[model samples]
Target: MSDIGRTSAVALVGVRGTLVEVEAHLTSQLPTFSIIGLPDTSLGEARERVRSAATVADCPLPSRRITVNLTPASVPKRGSGFDLAIAMAVLAAAGTAPGADRRTVYVGELGLDGRVRPVLGIIPVVLAARDAGVDRVVLPVGNLAEAQAVPGVTLTGVDSLRSAAIDAGADLPAGFVEPVLLPVPSDDTPPPLELADVVGNATGVRAVITAAAGGHHVLLLGPPGAGKTMLAERLPALLPDLDTDAALEVAAVRSVAGHGVRSWTHRPPWEAPHHSASAAALIGGGSAQLRPGAVSRATRGVLFLDEATEFPRVVLDALRQPLEAGRITVHRAGGSAEFPARCQLVLAANPCPCGNAGTVGGPACTCPPSAVRRYLGRLSGPLLDRIDIRVAVARVTTGTLRASDGTAPTTDAARRSIGDARERMRSRLRGTGWTTNADVTGAWLRSDGRAAPGASDLLDRALDLGTLTMRGWDRVMRLAWTIADLDGDDRPDRRHVERALALRMAL
Candidate 1:
């Protein structure tokens, strides 16, 4: 026997996958098995599973000193997906096969009864393999669908360890039982949300449309039952579908989060975490392995925070960096992982803690001035400054409710308008590496070449009066450009700038 064998595997770091080389060696010493190369708790336990599975599959390990080493010892390895690779390498060292195929990557969990079990994040693993130009991959049959999503590679799915060992040139028994895999439950299909469901909130609807068109952040201050949540939920409906690259990014994030990636969706995702969620849950971190949080999962979509004031100040403040940089990095004792955070933010809050301070003809304002100020102060000035649109949604009155006809704005109409505006933005920003006005740099927007002539008079006045910070003024300029795009104008004029200013100062 050669007493040496090698194969390939993958190690997951956040949503990224790094190729790993698995090597096995046998010697004439005490009979034992060991795995090295910074294997974590779950990965270290793969020894017992692989040994038992190999014995059950009629290809037992040699009764001599056995050692397996995952090359690139610096990278921390987690999860049990390396079981198949580890088993194949050891069996090949025992002369079961000439040698494990170095060009083939193996990923799957082995059961004591010899069944090959599926592992999470198979999509990212296959993607990494494809990127590395690997010729073939052997994984659990249960994950074949998601693994097939990545092209340019041959995939071989195995239902049992016996089947895999036999295919690897082992002289094993012919009778083999395939593991029974349960059918994946279908998603509960729900009717798509519509913009017309919201009644008597024209200003709120308009703000959502502008935000969708420009990919801008929004804040909604209103009393209860004013349709603030409705407006925020419907914003995604007005936006266009995600492109191929974005859709793949979304699927990769979901796979890393342990969500199903069988079928991908072009529509952007929507994440609405409760106010009581921990900071680690909203951001991305964990004690053992770093995981993607709500913000990362909401990438290329909307992150709506309902009852914004009820959340802890520190947790809410954690969003500032991601909002500016379009990505978030989480640090832990093990290592740091970066997650995508390029999503629109929508904050919905009551005018006061009492929820009736500004209701019309319905309740009295019992909250004192100091109490109201303290309640609203939960939203820090810096955070609010990042929000481009601040609209106050008034309570629906008898007149507004009675006049609510079906002629109100429809999602289809708003979508068409937003699509046209986005096309204009793409044309204008052809080589800027930016797709939306909100992503444009303030310096670039202020440059003479790209600046809209005679549109910054109001912004300059506001800056001189110290009413708007430099950041706020830049956001206003972006909003004005979006308005001009919606109107199909060559550039923003005084009217568009004025409308943008009003939206910023509405509350």
Candidate 2:
């Protein structure tokens, strides 16, 4: 008699999950099991896991030669998510009904004791199945909440290998109790922190707010005590909530990186890489599986770099492409994967080598002028020019600290203004596929988004006088458009361009 059956699972290629066909065959010979296809070490180990799980679940295997193949045999399968699927295929080949196995997608790790353990990247797997017109997905009970994030797909939860077999129409053991899925807890999202918490430095506070309003990159230069880090942390709170599609993409990235998502109502993420981070960590790279890095983690959110000068120039230069294109492509010998990295950049640095060189009341700096110049020069001109807002934060005064608490704009107030600005930009850019003022290109701005006649004259004079390069002129125009949107102006004027120029070149 012929003995062969097939099931399905998913393999995460980068952040995108592709459906994989799991087929099992049993031959009459001295019992030996082997798994084929280009599976990594973790997936190759699933054979022993599936065997032990089946034995514990009261399914005795007849001594026969068994071979499993994960088809699309050229694709690299990395994780152990195929364990349950492999077990079900084996059971079907052993004479269980194969109808359910043909209709559903199976993904979960099976333990030796018949327990089904949670695996990473569940969202992308279920999403891929649903998109492929496979309506039913049977995954671990622990993953049901995550599966709920994507609608339009039927989800089945199983806690052990025995349950999966029963779902596949295998006969249940006598007196076996059906597994109950536990209810996931609901955790309240705490209120976002306020911009009013910072003591002083109005320019620093304003620069952050403007950065949020325009989706512009920012550079904060000051001493250690100037509230640079605090300002960067609060920028996300003042920004608008992501739309449905953007939120799903963001959640998918987090899932692929092995972080579980309890809910999709998550805020835009924040990543603050230390000065010692490597280029691969900042951008994305790996020998086994090319993973998303800090930039991809900070997609549609903020990436703060404190002590920016301490980072090696090579590592820092790696950001230029993502900053321009809003995505990064990592090429490995196995393959290449592109990750979305459209993050708002924030870099905080000190004024000089000693940090006290230019301070008013601080002690004299010992470093020579040449040393100070070389220290700050690490931030290349091209990279610094890409940053739209540059603000120097001065030391907070005693009088400023003694003043009332609500001295500056609150994050709530700033959030309201920023939301209005974003809405305005969206309305203006409805058919342009650009959501924010920052995404507007230099060519597009020049062609269709010209400033008022008065503002245009001022900008032309600045360009002719060599105060602005061609790129600088474009960035200034982008900033002016953002300022105009924030103020509800129909078009930018000279005043807005002046403010934009001041905020533009402070490297």
Candidate 3:
């Protein structure tokens, strides 16, 4: 005699998920088990784990040939989250448990002790199930809170294979012991970094405000201890909170990167990769499973690259694509995956290797001119051109440090200004499918969002004189619009254009 059982599962590729069918076939032959449908190394090992777990859970497989297949077979599936579905399918085919509902998606890794352990990317997996119109999901108990973050889905959290089988209408032996659920670790958010803590560097602070206001990238060049890092860190505080869709997207990225997502928050993320990070680490690639990199993690937030010049030139140059496209696609031998990377890039670097070459009145420079040029040359022209704001942060004098007149900008004040500016941008770009000045194209800016009459004369001159590329002209126009919005102007005027030009040429 022969029997067939089927269930559903989700395969995550980057932040997206694809629904996969788990089908098991039982036949009266010598006892053997095999899994097919392009399973990866970790997924292929599910055979042993499922067998051991089913036995310990008192749901031993029938003494018959078993063939488990994940279809459509062309799609490459990775991870051990498929264990539960495979086990349930085998048991159902053996007539031990009732067949699983095809509408319900199963997602969780199984241990040898019959425990169903949580796996990464549950958020995206559940999200995929929701997107695929599968409203019910059976996952590990540990991920209940995370799965609850996504609405419109009925969740059934199981602690063990036996409990899952019982939930699936299996006739198990009596003496059911209630399973103990482990408490999910709380997602504790640290206190917000205050903008008021920065002592000096008014220009640096203003540059950060412009960045937060328009979602523009910034480059901060200065000596050490000039408050560059402080300014960069506080930019997020000056921006508004993320909306529901954005928060969910960010949570999905975190979940896929193995950073547990207990709940979603409106606060944007911040990623600061070290200089020693490889290209794969920054751009997102791996041999086993393609993972999200720092750029993807910083989607809808800030990506701070401190000591920017210390990074490898290739690694620095790799950011151009994500900055331009607002998304990153990692190609591997297995396949390709895309991740959202629309982030505000904040780069802080010393003027030279010795860190005192550009200071007004600090230690004398010891590094040679060639060394300084080489250090700064690591930042390619193409990469630098993509940055919208370039400001030189000079060392703060002792007099300036002590001359606080109680007029320093606070996070609340900056946030209000940025929020108002962003609102204005959204209004202006209502039907354009864009919400920030930086996202507007040159054609749109020239035709619809043009500056006041005769306001762009200097910009025209610069463009004609070969000092600025077309890309630079567009960037300056965007910066000018952001400045005008911050000042409550109907449109950019001469003053705004001049200020934007000065900021762009500050380095």
Find the candidate with the highest lDDT and give its number.
3
Off by over 4 Å in 3: 173-190, 402-404
Off by over 4 Å in 2: 174-191, 399-406, 458-467
* Per-residue accuracy of model 1 over 1-507 as CA lDDT, tens digit each: 337888899998877899999999999898999999999999999989998998888888889888999989998899899999999988878879654666889999999999999887787888888898897999898888777767788999888888887878888776657764535645532246899888888888889999999999999999988899988988877879998878878878877776554436688888899999988999889977788899998899999999999999889999998999999899998888888899999999998988988677879878999989988898999999999999999998978877775545889988999999999999989998989999999888878325466778889998999999999999998999998899999788889999999998998
Over all chains combined, what TM-score does candidate 3 have?
A: 0.96
Candidates arranged by lDDT, highest first: 3, 1, 2
- TM-score-wise, the better of 1 and 3 is 3
What are the RMSD figures for all models against the true structure? 2.1, 3.1, 2.0
In candidate 3, position 301 carries an lDDT of 91
Off by over 4 Å in 1: 173-176, 180-190, 402-404
Candidate 3 positional error at 152, Å: 1.3
- For model 1, where is the 10-residue window of minimal lDDT? 182-191
For each candidate in the order shown, give its overall lDDT on alpha carbons: 0.86, 0.83, 0.89
Q: Estimate, for each residue in 1-507, the C-alpha lDDT of model 2 and write its tens digit.
A: 449978888888777777888888999987978899999888899889988988888885657888999988987898788998888888888886455565688999888888888777788788889887888999998888877888899999888888888777778763343443334444433357888898777777878888898889999988768788888888889878888788878877777776665536558877888999999999989987788999998899888999998888888889999999999999998787888899999999988888876777767778899988888888888888788898887778787677635587888888998899888899998998999888998888778898887786766887899877787788889999998888899889998888888777543
204 in model 1: Cα distance from truth in Å?
A: 0.8
TM-score (C-alpha) between model 2 and the true structure: 0.91
Total clashes for model 2 = 0
TM-score of each: 0.95, 0.91, 0.96
